[model samples]
Target: MNSFNEEISSKLGLIRNTLSETGASAVRLRGTDWFAWATAGASNAVLLAAETGVAEVVVTAQAAWILTDEIEAERLQDEELPGTEDSANPLYKLYINLWADSAARESFIRDVTAGGKILSDRPTGDEAPLPSSLVKQKRVLIPCELERYRQVGRLASEAMTEVLSNAQPTWTEYQLAGASAQALWSRGLHPALTLVAGERRLPLYRHATPKEEPLGRAAMLVFCARGYGLYANLTRFVFFGSSQANAEIRNYASGHRHIREIEAEALNFCLPDKPLNGVYDVLDRAYHQHGYPQAIRQHHQGGTTGYLSREIIVNPSSSQTLAENMAIAWNPSLPGAKIEDTFIILKDGRLENLTFDPKWPSVKVEGRDRPVPLEID
Candidate 1:
C-alpha cells in the first residue's frame, strides 16, 4: 500500500483497538479536529467558528464510513476522498442524505451500527463519550502527518518573518493583523488565530486582539497557522526604538529575556515519560527565580498541539505525561512579554523546534537558539 493508505490503515487499527478496550462496537467522530485527523487532513469544517463540523466519520471494526448531507457529500467524495471513486477498493463508504432530512440521517446512523453500543467524540443521546485516553491517541503522529506538520510550520514561520519584517511604526494593530492573515493565506495556510498588540496595548492585555491602536515603538505578532489538519504556533516581536535610549523599551527587552529563560527551562523539561505537571512546576520556579513570581498565573502555559491549536493546555494540576513522538507548543507569558514555539518530542527524547526561522533574530539560551525581538533601529 501507498504511504497515505498505510497511514489511514494504522489510524483505523488504533480506533478498532479503542473499541475493543471500551467494549463498544463502533466509534463516531464529529469534532472538526477529529474529522481532519481521522481522514488524514480532509476538512469537515464549514463554519470555522464551530467546534463540530458538517460531516461525521464512523469507524467499525470491519469498515469505515463518511456520513454527511447531500450538500457536502459530492464535494467531499470528489475532492477530499481521493481514490474513493473505485468501487472495488474505496477508502470510506459514503452515506449521505438530504440536508433537510434530520429523521432520515438519524435512522441511517442507527441502522449502520445495528443497535450496538456507540461511542462518540461529541456524545449525544444514548451514545457514550469517548475516553480522553482514546482521544489522545491522535497526539502521536505517524510519519506522513509529521512531514505535513513540518511543511505547515515552515510556511507559518516564513509568513511571520515576511509580515513582521516589513512592519512600520505607524501601522495600526488592525493593519498588522490584516497583513498577517494575507501572508498565511497566500502560503496556503489558514490563520486560525492572529493576535497583534501594539506598544500601548502590549502591557495591558495578555490575549490582545487586534485594534485601531497604532504601533508606537514596539509590537508583538502571534499566529496560530493551520494547514492539513495540523497547527503551528509562533510569536514574534518588533521594536522600532533604541533599547538603550528608552527605559520602557529597555524594560520590555529585559522582561522578554526573562520569559525566554522560562521558556528554555520548559523546553528542556520536555522529555519522554515525564509528567506534564513537572514541566509546569519548572516554569513556576523559573518565573519565581527570575523575580516574576506571579507570571505563571497570568497566562496558561501551552501544551500538546496537533490537529487542534492546543490538544492540551498544561497546568499545575495536569495529569498527562509527556511522551515520545508527541508535538508540544509551550507559551510562557508575562504581561508585555511572551514566548512561544511549536516543538516535537522525537523518538529519542529530544525536543525539536518546528517553527525556527534562521533569519529571525535570536539569542543562545541554555545551548539552544531562542528567538529574540527584532530591532529595526
Candidate 2:
C-alpha cells in the first residue's frame, strides 16, 4: 500500500479503538467508508437527489448504506441504482483491515461501495430494522487537521480580492468566476460553488451560474471555499455603472450596509453566558431591517466552522453554545443590490473580515476604509 493510504488506515484503526472506548457504539469507520460518503452523492445528485430521505448515509464499523426507500419503487423494481450496475464507487471509500484477520470491516466496505457484491446492504435477506441509537445521531466528520482549512479560507479571500481589482464593465460574469477559481487553485483551495450573475439576471437565483453573456450594471459572486474538511463562504458584488442605477437597488444597498452594521454589533453578543441563539436572533432582525422579511429560511445564513459547514445552520431555533476557538463566517447577503464580507467571529469579540473588497477603491464603514466594488462615474 502507498504510504499515505497506509498511514490513513492506521489512524482509522486508532479512531475505531478510541470510539469503541468513548463513542456511542465503539465503532470506527474506515477511510474507505469516508470516501464512500463523499461521492455517494454524485449518483444520487444526477438521478436520485430529488428523492426524499436519500440525504444521509449511515456509516458504522459493521455497515455503510443509504435508504433504498428514496430510490423510487419503480427504479428499484427495474434494477439497481444507475451507478450500481456493477456498483463499485471509488469515491465511497473505506478502510479494509488488510493487515488484520478481520473480514467484517473489509467486507463491509466492499459491500457498501459495490451495492453488496461482497456483502448485502441488509446483510441478510430478512428485513432488519435500523438501530434506535442511530436515530438521534448526526454524521459530521471532522478531519484531524485544522490549520489547513483556515489556510484555504484565507487564500480564497485573497484570490477574490485579486479578481475584483481588474474587473471591467465588459467582462462576462463567468469569466470573473473562472478567474476567482484559478486564483483559489493557485493558493491550494477547493471550489464548492462559483456563482456569478450579471445585472440582467439579478436576484433570479442565489446560486446563479453565469451565462455566456456580457455583464451590464452589476455582478454578484458567492463561493463556498473549502479545504481540510471545512467551508468558509462569502459573497461579493461588483458594479461598473454609476451608483444611481436603480432606486430599489440603491435602497437595498443602503439596507445591506445597515445589515452589516447589525452584524458588526452582534459580534460582541457571543458571550458564553449568552445563548448562541441570541446571535441568530440579531441576524434575523438585521434581515427584517434590510427589507427581507423572509430571509432566514431563504438560504442558510451561517453555521459552525472547523471541519466543513455544520449540519446545523445557525438559525433562530438552534441552541448550540458559542465555544472558544470556533471559527465562524457569518455572511448574510441580499440577492442583487449588495452583499458584504465573511467576518470571522473571534474569541475576544474582535471581527476579522475574511473576504475583503480591498484594492477596488474605498468607502468608510465604522471608521475603516472598506473597498467599494461597485464603481461609479
Candidate 3:
C-alpha cells in the first residue's frame, strides 16, 4: 500500500481499537478537527463559526462511512474523500439524505450500527461522548501530517515577513490587521485570528484586537493561520522610531530581550517525558528572576498545539507531560513584550522550529535563532 493509504488504515485501526475498548458498535466524528485528522486533511467546515461541521464520519470495526446531506455528498466524494473510483478497498462509503430530513439521517445511522451503542465526539441524543483520552490521541502527528504542518508553518511565516517588513508608523492597527489577513488569504491560508497593537495600546491590553489607532512608533502583529486543518501561530513586532532616541522604545526593546531569555529557558525545559508542571515552574522562576514576578499571573503561557490552536494549556498544576513527536506553541508574554513560535519535538528528542524564516532578522538566544523586533527607521 502507498503511504497515504497506510496512514488512513492506521487511523482506522485506532478508531477500531477505541470501539473495542469502549464496547461501542461505532465511533462518530462530528468536529472539524477530527474530520480533518481522520480524512488526512479534508475539511468538513462550511460555517466557520460553528464548532461542529456539516457532515460526520462513522467508523466501525468492519467499515467506515460518511453521512452528509445531498448538498455536500457529491462534492466531498469527488474532491475530498481519499481512494480512487476503482480501488479494491475504498476508505469510506458515502451516505446522503435530504437537507431537511433529520429522521432519514437518524434511521440510516441506526441501521448501519444495527441499533448498537454509538459513541460520538459531540453527542446529541442517546449517544455517549467520546473520551478525552481518545481526543488526546491526535497529539502525536503521523508522517503525512508532519509534512503538511511544515508546509503550513513556512507559509504562515512568509506571510508575516511579507506584511510586517513593510509596516509604517502611519498605518492604523486596523490597516495592519487587514494587510496581514490579505497576505495569509492570498497564500491560501485562513486567518483564524489576527491581532494588532500599536505603541499606545500595547502596554494596556495583552490580547489586543485591532483598532483605528495609528501606530505611532511601534506595533505588534500576531497571527494564528490555518491550512490543511493544522494551525501555525506566531508573533512579530515592528518599530518605526530610533531606539537610541526614545526611552520608551529602548525600554520596550529591553523587555523583549528579557522575555526572549525567559522563552529560551522554557524551550530548553521541554524535554521528552518531562512533566508539564516542571516547565511551568521554570517559567515562574524565570519571570521572577527577570524582575517580572506578576507576568505569569497576567497571561497564560501557551502549550501543546495541533488540530486545535492549543491542544493543552500548560499551568503550574498541569498533569500532561511533554512527549516526542508532539507539536508545541509556547507564547511567553509580559505587559509590553511577548514572543511565540510553533515547534515540534522530533522523534530524536530535538526541538525543531517549524515557522523559522531565514529572511526575517533574528538574534541568537542560547544558541538558537530567535525572532526580534524589526527596526524600520
Candidate 4:
C-alpha cells in the first residue's frame, strides 16, 4: 500500500479505538481539521462559504462514508481518491455517500445514528467534545506528515522572504499581502492565513490584517500556508531606506531581549514529558524578568501545529504535555518585537527547526540565531 493509504488505514484504526474508549460506536467528521486528519490529505470536498458544513465523513468500526453533493463527490472520487476498485482495496470501503436527494442525506444520518453513540467534531444535536485525547494523538506527526511539514515550511519561508524583500516602501499593506499570497499560490499552496502590518500598524495591532496603508519604512508579513492537508506558518520583516531609517526598527528588534529569552526558554522546556503549562511558566518569568510582565497577556504564545494552524494552543492554564515527534510553533510576541518559528521535538530530546532558511539574514539574539528584519536601501 502507498503511504497515503497506509495513513488512512492507521488513522481509521486509531479513530475506532478512540471512539470505543469513549463508548461511541461512530464519529461524524465535519471540520476541516478533523476531515483532513481522517482522509490523510483529501481536502477538495470542503466548501468554506457554505455554512451547512456540506461535506461530512462518518466512520464506524466496519465502514467509513464521505457524504457530499454529486459534483464534489464525483470529482473527489475521480481525481483525488486514487485507490483501486477491487474489493480488496484498503480504501475500497470508503464509499462516497453522495446526496443526490434530500432523503438520501437523512437516511445516511439515520443509519449511522442507529449503529450506536455518534461523536462529532461539529456537534449539532448530541455530541461530546472531540475527545481532548484525540487532539494529542493528531498533533503528534507521523513520518509522512513530518516530511510534508518540512517541505511546506521551506516553501512558505522562501515565499514570504522573497515577497516581503521585494516589497517597495510605496506599496500598501494590501499590496504586500497580495504579492505574498501570489507567491504561495504559485507553489500550489493555499495562503490560509495572511497578516500584513506596516510601520504605522505594528506597535499598535498584534494581529493586523493587510490594509491600504503604505508599508512606509518597515512592515511585518506573516503567512500560514496549507497544502497536503498540513500547515506551515512563518513571519518575515522588511525595512526600507538608509541606515538611519532602519535604526528605529533595529532598536525595536533589539528590544525583544525579553521576548527572545522567553521564546528560547519556552522551546527548551518543550522536552518530552514536560507539560505545556511549564513552557508558559518559563515565558511568564522571562517576560517579567525583562520588565514586560504584562506582555504575554496581550496575545497567545502559539502551540503544536500540523493539521491545523494551532492544533492546541499553549496558555498559562493549559494542562497538555509535550510529546515526542510533535511539531510546535511557539510565537511569543511583545509590542513591536516578536520571534516565531516552527520546530519539531524529536524522541531524543532534540528540536528540529523546520522553518530555518539560511538565505534570510539572521541576528544572534539572546545567544541564539534568529531571522532579522531585512534592511533595504
Question: TM-score per candidate, in order?
Answer: 0.97, 0.62, 0.95, 0.92
Please give the CA lDDT of all the candidate structures. Answer: 0.88, 0.51, 0.87, 0.78
Candidate 4 local lDDT, 1-377, one digit each (tens): 77777888888888888878998878888877776777776674355423234466777777777777775766776765665223564453444444557677656777866846778877876666678877678888888888888898888888877897789999999999899889998997888889988989988888998999988887888887887767887777777876365577767766565566778888777898899888888888888888888888899889888877887788877788889989889888877777788889999988887776888988675455678778788
lDDT of 2 by residue, 11-33 (tens): 34443443354333323221222
TM-score of 4: 0.92
- Scored against the true structure, residue 101 in model 2 reaches a CA lDDT of 38
Q: Encode model 3's per-residue lDDT on 122-202: one tens digit a residue.
A: 888899988766776788887789999999999999999999988889999999999999999999888889999999999
Q: What is the lDDT, from 0 to 100, of the residue 243 in candidate 3?
A: 80
Q: Which of the two candidates, 3 or 4, achieves a greater lDDT against the reference?
A: 3
Candidate rank order under TM-score:
1, 3, 4, 2
lDDT of residue 36 for candidate 4? 72
Task: Flag the better candidate by TM-score, 3 or 4.
Answer: 3
| Decoy 2 TM-score against native | 0.62
Model 2 residue 297 CA deviation (Å) reads: 4.4
Q: Assess the local accuracy of residue 138 in candidate 1 as a C-alpha lDDT between 0 and 100.
A: 87
Best by TM-score: 1
Off by over 4 Å in 3: 82-87
Q: Where does candidate 4 have its weakest 10-residue lDDT segment?
A: 44-53
Model 1 deviation from native, Cα RMSD in Å:
1.3
Clashing pairs in 1: none
Query: Candidate 4 — which residues are off by over 4 angstroms?
Result: 44-54, 83-87, 90-103, 113-115, 243-247, 364-368
Best by lDDT: 1
